[model samples]
Target: MKKIILGIILLFNFSLVAQNPILDIHTADFANIENAYYKDIDNFYNQFVGTWIYTDSVKIIRFKFVKKEMFYRQSIKSCYVDYLVGEMQYVENGVEKINSLINLNINHSEIYNYNLYSYGKTNKDWYPKCLECPDTIERLPMSYNEPTNDDAGLEAAFVMHRADENGVEKIKIQYIETIGAYGIKPDGSPSITTNFTIPYGDYILIKEN
Candidate 1:
């Protein structure tokens, strides 16, 4: 009886401390993964971290980004992931309309705790699809949620690109919006209109630091 009890304890401890297979996010299959840690082993998330700004005569916007590591994600199964979380500040016509960047440095317990968050490395293929983006280059995809978009009835996918623009480093974000088949209504009907306040188009941002 004593020996049986000892063996059980040993097995349990091993399971708890056992290292899960670590995978690079670029080529990972996000589903059906069990006890695996999706890692940014190459530090791909670093380049996008920090402050990026976009400005025109009328509109000025800034996006602040940071990498949050080893977040527990619940899907069909439980897995650990590394990803980017972001906050935005928007101004148009000299009036500040939105700003959520104040809490960017404070790590939230959940990704959805923020307005924008996503995981995945440079992706070769994505949905709502990238039209002008070349297949040869991979882009980082992120999903955005506005606090007032409780029933916005639209999908906003923003993909990031890094390149040299006129001898300066710039990040290009393509904001692609898509309409879904479902709605917030209990009757299972889509919303008749959208409540999107953000502008739609490509934004060119410069690194602030």
Candidate 2:
């Protein structure tokens, strides 16, 4: 009997394609590999899974992330990718804002329609806050997009840890929303910058004990 092994190695130096964990793509350099199965090999996406809450006098929000794996991607090339699907409960200034916690299931094939989508973690040498006091820390990168608003898409850059010195898991996110530049708008104009109802800003969220 003869064994037949095949590999589909595609060299894409110009454009990124078939990257695992496509939400944030764990790899620093795009690999020309076979089968578009962007698996979370390092398990970086696991830390973001669970319920996180941030509260203050005027703002309160509870966010949850669920892992969606082996999801087929059709935006560019057809491939299975991994992503952290997010849902949230938001309120500001004593007024109820957005609450989609009731719809926190991870059965949706389309990741872009969710409140947040993230995959993998990365550490920056320039912004290494804790050089001496702790374990490995990495940032969770995600994007926020409200399904109804086409113009509202923001990049969520979050720095997270499983626990602190006091053993409290925390995550810090930037207050300002970084708009994603996919391309120009449908009318051939620039992409519009927009904010969300969720006071998604500079916040330190603590995981539920």
Candidate 3:
């Protein structure tokens, strides 16, 4: 009877562990520091280091500056001067869940150029999804051609679309990207933009702890 009870307890513990498997977030290995451009673009990169909440949806995004590293593939080497990591989370059915993760690589010379990578869990395993993907969104200084009534100095525009069996529609999310210098107005005033800018409407986000 004692042996049977011990076996049952061990089996129950194993079952519990199997049901809730641990996920490894740090599975990505970093290459040697090829080039560091954080010093050059520190001002631009610093603006993204914070927790941003989306008011339209239950989504929250946080960005933090990471180390500069070089990635190589197919004998091609590209240096990421200012590396920023972002995590996205949302609530579903009253349960908060991580939707996806992203790593951004910014060029030192072209502050607007950004290389993005999607990192998250796939089939219960963490993997880096897009590496040097062609689809990229850039932050450009507000051009005189694209005028806005709002007093914004910069703007980031990306053209995207959603496709279904019905067809597709051209969509562009152009809005006030950043405000002030280093996220503050020139006159020492505080101005912030919405987290997610969509064609349908602009949504506001609150900072999360």
Q: What lDDT would each prediction earn against the true structure?
A: 0.76, 0.61, 0.32
Q: Per-candidate TM vs. native?
A: 0.78, 0.66, 0.30
Worst 10 residues of 1 by lDDT: 180-189
C-alpha-based local distance difference test score of model 3: 0.32
Put down candidate 2 lDDT per residue, 23-92, tens digits, no spaces: 3257733223333667677777887788989998888888888888777666545666777778777778
lDDT of 1 by residue, 122-206 (tens): 5546754557667776678887866556554566778886755787868888886776424564355555536456697888899
Error of 2 at 186 (Å): 6.9
lDDT of 3 by residue, 61-98 (tens): 32222333322211132333323333344444446443
Models sorted by lDDT, best on top: 1, 2, 3
Please tell me which model should have the higher TM-score, number 1 or number 3: 1
Look at candidate 3 and tell me the lDDT of residue 120. 19
Q: Considering every candidate listed, which one attains the maximal TM-score?
A: 1
- Give the top-scoring candidate (lDDT): 1
lDDT of 1 at 201: 87
